[model samples]
Target: MASALRRARAGEGPVLAWPLACGSTVAERTRAVDFAQGVLRVEVPDVGWRKELQSFAPQYLAVINRYVGESVKRIEFILAGQQLADRADKNGRSTRV
Candidate 1:
């Protein structure tokens, strides 16, 4: 059961990371970001990082809009969850990942 759940989460992982792909340097450190039902949700690695990102929300949104080629009106940031945080740490320096 645990393994199955892990697999499911692993599959959904990429979907969550998609929006952070072209974001700012702060966004580059992001663990996950998802656009669902008109809301953009982001997960950063830590509180300090989250605060740093909040200061630059507008810039991050602009980058997201450019990468996605659409207007993203809102963004919410949080402390990264387990699976997502691990992925971020692994791929934090790779733009092509």
Candidate 2:
């Protein structure tokens, strides 16, 4: 099901559009989790980053929309806590900030 979903929306996902929208510098400090119902969920390192990025939502929306086919209407910035990062690190997953 997951693979099918990915296949169906392969080129139209906001997750893929994020890096291009924010650029490498910002992208390196964040992770685009998913997009659904016009909302794109992005994980930031902490509150400072979340607040900083949230302020740029409108602009991000514009760029994201262009690549996502105007499907993302809102950007939701969530915190990527140290606990989460630690877990990812323990699991050998990238806990990039």
Candidate 3:
């Protein structure tokens, strides 16, 4: 299967195009982890950012969905480091604190 980035590219989705559309500052500390089941998983720096960012989820979702033809239904924000460990665990790699 093509990676989410590749799929986003092929579909012209927000995964790679968001930073170009949105301001660099908004995308700087944020990352697109996965887009599936109409949910866009985003990784933010911390809880404060997450809470602040959550308020913008609706707006972001609108722009993203509009850009990608309603491909995204929601934006789920997670912690950057937590997302990394989650990915590692998914790949069967042990994560050490």
**What TM-score would each prediction reach against the true structure?**
0.51, 0.70, 0.71
Question: What overall lDDT, based on C-alpha atoms, would model 3 receive against the true structure?
Answer: 0.72
Deviation from native of the Cα of residue 48 in model 2, angstroms? 0.3
Q: lDDT per prediction?
A: 0.56, 0.77, 0.72
lDDT of 1 by residue, 1-97 (tens): 2233234342343334344543456546775555554446777788897787778777766555544433457667777674455466688653334
Say which prediction, candidate 1 or candidate 2, comes out ahead on lDDT.
Answer: 2
Tens-place lDDT per residue, model 2, 37-75, is 887888898999988998899999887665554477788
Q: Identify the candidate with maximal lDDT.
A: 2
CA RMSD per model (angstroms): 13.0, 7.8, 5.2
Alpha-carbon deviation at 75 in model 1, angstroms: 1.4
Candidate 1's C-alpha runs over 4 A off are 1-28, 82-97
User: How would you encode candidate 3's per-residue C-alpha lDDT over 1-97 as one tens digit per residue?
Assistant: 1244345554346576566445689799888877667777888889999999899787777666655643777778899788778878999997886
CA lDDT, candidate 3, residue 51: 96
